[model samples]
Target: MSQSLDRALTLLGSLGDGPVSLGQAAASIGVHKSTALRLLRTLEEHGFVHRLSDRRYRLGGRVLSLAQRALQGIDVRQVAAPYLAALHERFGCTVQLAVLEDDEVLYLDELTGRWSTGAGLPDRIGRRAPAAGTAIGRVLLAGLPQDGRAEEELPAELAAVRRRGWAAESSGHLETVTSVAAPVAGSDRRAVAACAVSAPADRVSPAELVRLVPELLCTAEAISLAYGGSPTPRWCENRCGARPVVRASRT
Candidate 1:
């Protein structure tokens, strides 16, 4: 593997246990402290890693987002594209693929409604969102590992999503947008990402959002299976889908 890829996996493996000091991380990864710091810094810039107030490092919010996009740009999205487009056409709304990084939700890819201003929003392929208010955020938050102190409220609805299989939001994150999301798992049987749909609150209801759960779950699972993830994840899953599509392929 390339040096960067090797370092990233090392960082990820180290983070699976809990937050650690830079020194510990360097030692665990068998790299010089300076080299580890440089790698961490690079990962931080891409949203794949985070640095705590104490200078400890953790996973960042962009990791999931980028991973999902990477998967979509590969084979899973290509396979799911028709399904995603069909869903968008049926609902005339926006469909989003989201993944967890740190304590946030990151957009992987989206299919927007004809009348939607989704393109105007900052939710490009790698845009990040607070994993609190939005339905996608709730879905991701619900799937996050309980390894470290979250430092955020774990709402009942979000908790319910973990118990159940989905979550919804009604004009919570945005002023008038309603959303529904479902968890996606990784090979470790953990929730790593989610798939969601969003529409104008005026045009969608809580019941309707709940009804969309199965479809979102299907999409998420398809992506997860593509990534060789398990049928069930312990926390969250990575929906890379089975195929690896690079951004260059999209371009």
Candidate 2:
């Protein structure tokens, strides 16, 4: 790589130790303090670094925004498409794939199942819902680390979801609807999205929906693995033990 590019990347990596002063960065990277300041200024102009009031430099919001956009383009929905269709075929319940976006569950894809009510559960693709209320939300939230928000700010149902490793809701977002969801994790074992099945409450009563937990969990694992998620002990027992196996991404 060019010297400037190499130096910039070296400086970026150095900031991982937290904010650094020009002298500290120069000494660490084997560059003069003046050269380090010039590089830092270039990075600041691009919003890749921020100079603090104390004259230390740290990462900037632009870097965070870029990382978020990269995560959003991970193609989990594409990776899970066939599995979702198979899940829909098995139970004939609406199958949905969603990701948590700014405290809301943003529906990325949906497959209408055979048992769809055709009334209560509308086509949810391109739609969003509060993350504290829906089954998918609970599953996604359960996978996240606890942030010390007030208990009242979070729904009590999340506790049950964490304990059960899954979540289900009756009349969720729509009257007479029942929805069950499981987390779809990434390579880091962090839930990047959720897989959910929705049907009319009368047709797929909560008790009957409970019976589908195994299948839902299995499908989620299959999708998670396809997306490069590290396999858990349960997943190791029989990795992706589901039908219509999804092909893992080569990338």
Candidate 3:
């Protein structure tokens, strides 16, 4: 790699801990003071670094903007499509992908399963639903930080979902329909979206739905991995507080 490119990347990596002085940055990257100053000036010109009042430099707004643009380019629906299809094939239930948008659950994709009753399912892409009333919404809401939301401010259902690391609803939002969901986490180990399966209440009893949790979790993990997120067996223990007695063997 070119010396400038290498130094720039190293500088970017070093800033992860916080701002750095020019001398400190140069010493850390093994570059001369003059060379480092020139590089910092270049980075500042491009909005990649900000020179602080104290003479230290920190990451700039453009870094965050670039990160956001990169994330926007990653189509979660595209990444999760095969997993959703596999889940549908396994359970023969309507599979849905959703993300929190505008404080609501926005359906990104849907695949009708053979046995799905299809009642109350958000069949179309871009369908919106109240986050408090749907399985996917509950999982997404549960994954959000609770500090700003007072205990009373949070819905009881969402609190329960957070405790359980999963959510299920019977005849909720739509009569005679059942849905279960889990988080599709990103690299931050937070829900960027959710994966859910819906079926007729009669076709999928609560007990059967519980049995499907392992598959649901595995599918979610697969999607998370596809999105460059870390996936570990500990997800069940950390998020659900319960480990699957019967782990789903990778196929």
Please tell me which predicted candidate would have the highest lDDT against the true structure.
2
Report how far residue 48 has shifted in candidate 2, in Å.
Answer: 32
RMSD for each of the candidates: 12.5, 13.2, 15.2
Ranking by TM-score: 2, 3, 1
TM-score of each: 0.55, 0.62, 0.59
After superposition, which runs of candidate 1 have C-alpha atoms over 4 Å from their true positions? 1-83, 117-123, 148-155, 232-251
Model 2 global lDDT (CA atoms, 0 to 1): 0.80
Q: How big is the positional error of residue 239 in model 1, measured in Å on the Cα after superposition?
A: 19
What is candidate 3's TM-score against the reference? 0.59
TM-score of 2: 0.62
Q: In model 3, what is the error at residue 210, expressed in angstroms?
A: 2.2
**lDDT per prediction?**
0.69, 0.80, 0.78
Highest TM-score: give the candidate number. 2
Better of 2 and 3 by lDDT: 2
| Per-residue C-alpha lDDT of model 3 across residues 1-251, encoded as one tens digit per residue | 99899999899878866899999999979989999999999999999999999999999989878865754555887788888887787678788888897679877788986664445443546467899888889899888877777655777877778666789887665877777899987766778899987777777786677678777887887777766665454344554443334332222
Worst 10 residues of 1 by lDDT: 242-251
TM-score of 1: 0.55
Superior by TM-score: candidate 2 or candidate 3? 2
lDDT of 2 at 179: 84
